[model samples]
Target: MSISRLHIERVRNIQTAALHQLQPFNVFYGQNGSGKTSLLEAIHILATGRSFRTHIPKNYIQTQQADALIFAQAHQEKMGIQKFATGEQLIKVNGDSIATQGQLARLLPLQLIDPQSTDLIDNGAKPRRQLLDWLMFHVEPDFYHAWQYYARALKQRNTLLKTKRQPTLADLEPWNQMLAEYGELLHSQRLSVLQQWQTFFLHDLQMLLPEIAVQIDYRAGFHPELGLANELQHAHSKDVERRYTEYGPHRADLRFKTALGDADVVLSRGQKKLLVMALKLSQIAMLHASNKETVVLLDDLTAELDSTAQRRLIERLSQLGSQVFLTTLDHVAVQQHLNDLSISYQLFNVDKGQIHAVEPTIYN
Candidate 1:
């Protein structure tokens, strides 16, 4: 799915902006603080009901504005999100109000690559786990429901553990049973998706980081032999001490390793970025193969990657039939690469919160 039109209001420095006839590849270029990134943020918010840049709505909402609005038309359906500074949100699809963000997210599956993307490697397991869940949520039809149920059970269990420091085994049985039922399902779903994702990931690794031999290691966060139910029962004391359910799918993680060590440790900064790109690109490839087109938001493309890497990334995205919205400081360089590849795109220049479509300069 691709956005054919987008309208934004009171988001960051962008007071109001609108674009029509967006192409498969859309490029936005400008200097620092020119609102290019803000434009991408608007699209991200519209799709996910949250900003990649910040968790606080007031931070992204225009200064002095009470709320920020983002609306878009994807194919025949129209989706919109309005985030208020008071932490309230209004989401609607096709002019009807919606209660959950998942409804909107299902309509638009977005993959974002930004300067901070390297955190996937260097940071903790949360981001990596999120990567896996993103794929599972899109590919596995039942994954979301399972995840919701598992999350509720996990929360109840953790709260009981925290409130009643010495809660009896009987007290925890119900939550354990719920956790075992849904947790196992989540683990199974994640493993199934990961197995398929690994094939695509390896292909992308060969293309993006051919020299580096990388392996994906998945931790189910519970002992496979004893199973989650038995483990939860056995770890009751530990859970009580920690005030949380420690062993479950909630703590699952994906680790990337090379012969030398973890990718974050062995690879250079540039290599880490490429590896992250490969991970995301592989997800796009897998989704594309399933006939689910992904919309990619690439921030500061030229600054984050070298020319060759940039070309390779763009080429791969195009081949996967991904609709990409890219932000760059050098439109000419990006335009030249797109021209060389004979890729059709819409070029826009962002300045002082204003966005204007510009004609591309053709080169021989």
Candidate 2:
């Protein structure tokens, strides 16, 4: 669903703002600190009930502001959000209260590409797991509950391990059983998702980054020989000593290998960016197949891409029939580049925390 109208209040530097009649291809161009990126962040917050820029939702509210509110009308369905400075956020979809982020995700699925996206390949395993889990959450119906159950059980087991009075086998048995059952379920589901991705995503990845020979492999978080239950049993003493569950889906990670060796040891910064972009695009493709029109948020869309690469990525996105929100600080260069590519797009000008729709001719 594309947002036709958006209302933002007390977010970042924008005390109040509204953008109406939003289009499929929306561009926000302005000088630094004009709040261009904040607009995209607001849109992201509305979609995910979380900000891509910061983990702390409270920090998104303007300084001295007690709360922030965002309301969006898309595809004739209304979604409203009230995020308090106290770390509480409320969501109402179509006038009905929503408590689950999954519910909001089902309504507004989006893919984001930004400077930090390279972390998908360059950083630790958490980001890769997050990327894959987002895909699984959308495609697999039972994934969310299974994941939720597994997390709760893991927390309980960790707490038990940390108790001053050591937990007996009987005390740990129930959580271990729950963790094993759900962990295997997660393992099965993750493996299934990876198989499906391999069916077409490999080819799709090639299309995005032809020169990079990066490979993706999944580690199921436990030794295949020992299995989850046995691994948990064997690690019990160490887990108690460490005060946390160590060998389960929580430790799952996606390993990146390349023709030269491990990707981190071989691929350049630019190659890693392109590889991550391909992986994200493939994920969006899988979702778009059924969702029809996934909203794409591209921050600094041309940041690491050359002119040719920029043209390719934008055109590829357009072919998916997706709505794209893009930001660029170098308006003249970006405008000229898009003009050279010969595509029509809407431009919004941001200045001093205010944004207004600008006529296309303003570029001329």
Candidate 3:
């Protein structure tokens, strides 16, 4: 679904802004510190109940403000979020209060491509695992509940390991059973999604990085032969030594590899960025194939990619029917590219804590 209206309040430099009649492509342009990124952050907060900029609410919420508010309408459904400085949040859909963020996420699936997106390749496993789980959460209907169960069980098991120095098998049996049950379910769901995602990923790789041969690998975080139950039983001693559960789906990772070595190690900085783009764009394509449209948040469109790459990226996104919100410093450059492709878009010029829509110029 695409957002038609967006409202923001008390968010970073943006004290208050209301945008209406958003098109398939919405471009925000301004100088540094012009609150353009904050506009995208507001929508990210509304979709996921958090900010991509900072984890702390006080950093993104305007100084001295009690909370930041974001609201949007997609068709007849309305979603809103209020994030307090004290780390409390209230999410609502269609004017009714909601308990979980998944409800909002299921309605509005967002794919974010920012300066930090390369962290997926350069950083450790958590971000990569999160990327995989985000796909599972969207495409797999039962993934969220299974993940909830596995996380709860994993937490209990870890707490037990920390508290009891010599807990016997019987002491950990119940939690282990729960973990194995849910963890195995999560593994199956993730494996199925990953297999399908790899197909789409390879196609995008060809289009975006044809010269590079990259392989996506999945580590299940457990012994494939022994299974989670058997592995947990075998790792009891190691678990006590480390004071945490070591092996399970919780530790799963996705490794990007090439003929020479890992993608991060073998590829240059620019190449790594393109690889990350392929990963995210492939995900959008996969979801689109299933008739689920994704809202893409692209921060600094021109900075991360060259002119040719930007044109290809925009063309791919347009072909997939994604509603895009992008930020850039050069409006003329971005507008020129969009005009050359004959793509319809709405432009908004952002200033210090304020935003104004710029009427589009017709080009023949």
Candidate 4:
């Protein structure tokens, strides 16, 4: 599935723009600060119904504007042209006009590859855990409801612990029951997803970089048996001091490690980019295997990758056969790879937040 056309008004620097209907490989060329990333972010928002960049929805609105609008038309093989529209600088899917953000995500499934993804490897565990939960939510619809219920209960429980003058270990019994019940189900679902992802990632890694091995491990917040109350009891003092949740799956992490020695840990910036690309390719494979079509948004396709790794990544992306929207600054770079694959793609030259199709004088 791929977005055929997109209409944007008052989104960041893009006051008004229209991206002509796209294809298997759609490339956008422009200089830095020319809104390439913003364009890609718009597509990502439309697909996932959430900003992959900043949490501040207001930031998406133009400086003086109160609201922003993004309209898209996607062509799914089984389901004809699906039109989606959003109001007040929000993300929407299939024009259903849902009030909830998550409801929009279920409609336009997507996998994104951006420079920020390196955070998953070098930074905190939140990003990696989010990846797992995102995939799980798509697979299990009811999981979202369970997640919401648990989040509400957890918030109330934490608030009580913080404000109650006489905080006791036993006071959390009721909340613990609710938290444990939902947490267990969520953990079980995540474990199943991780198992499936392990196979997918291993296979894709072999194809993309056979010399290296990759593994993903899930570490829960605490032992399942301790229950929420017992865990809270153990951390009562710390909780009182911090006045917030010091422990829970929310604090858990997904660890990525290699069997290779520690000396192999030092990866150049470019190598880190390649590793991130490999993971995204693996995610696309998993999404495909699940019988789902995902719209892929790639920001600055040639940023830190060496020519060889770039070619390899492009080839793998092509094999995935999903509709891709990519941005780059090098004309020759895009031409060489697109020619190598002998695939016809649409080219749009972006300038001052506007996009226009550029025709090649000759075909290779």
lDDT (CA) per prediction: 0.92, 0.83, 0.92, 0.72
Best by TM-score: 1
Candidate 1 backbone collisions, by pair: none
How would you encode candidate 4's per-residue C-alpha lDDT over 1-364 as one tens digit per residue?
A: 5677788777678888877757888888889988888888777666555577776667676776666666777664211111122234333344344566675566667888887767767777788778777777777666798889778878977898779865665776677678777877777777777788778788777766677676766787766667654676687778767777676777767776677532126655555556666777777788787777677888887877667777877777777777888899886787688788776688888888888888743336
Candidate 4 wrongly placed segments (more than 4 Å): 76-96, 225-229, 260-265, 360-364
In model 3, pairs of residues that clash are none
lDDT of 1: 0.92
Candidate 2, residue 273: CA error in Å?
Answer: 1.0
TM-score preference between candidates 1 and 3, better one:
1
lDDT of 2: 0.83
Question: Which of 1 and 2 is ahead in TM-score?
Answer: 1
Give the TM-score of each candidate. Answer: 0.99, 0.95, 0.98, 0.89
* Candidate 3 RMSD to the real structure: 1.1
Global CA lDDT computed for model 4: 0.72
TM-score preference between candidates 2 and 4, better one: 2
lDDT of 1 by residue, 259-361 (tens): 9998888899889999999999999999999999999999999876889999999999999999999999888888888999999899999999999999888
Clashes of each: 0, 0, 0, 1
**Poorly placed runs, candidate 2 (over 4 Å):** 336-344, 362-364
TM-score of 4: 0.89
User: How many residue pairs of model 2 clash at the backbone?
Assistant: 0
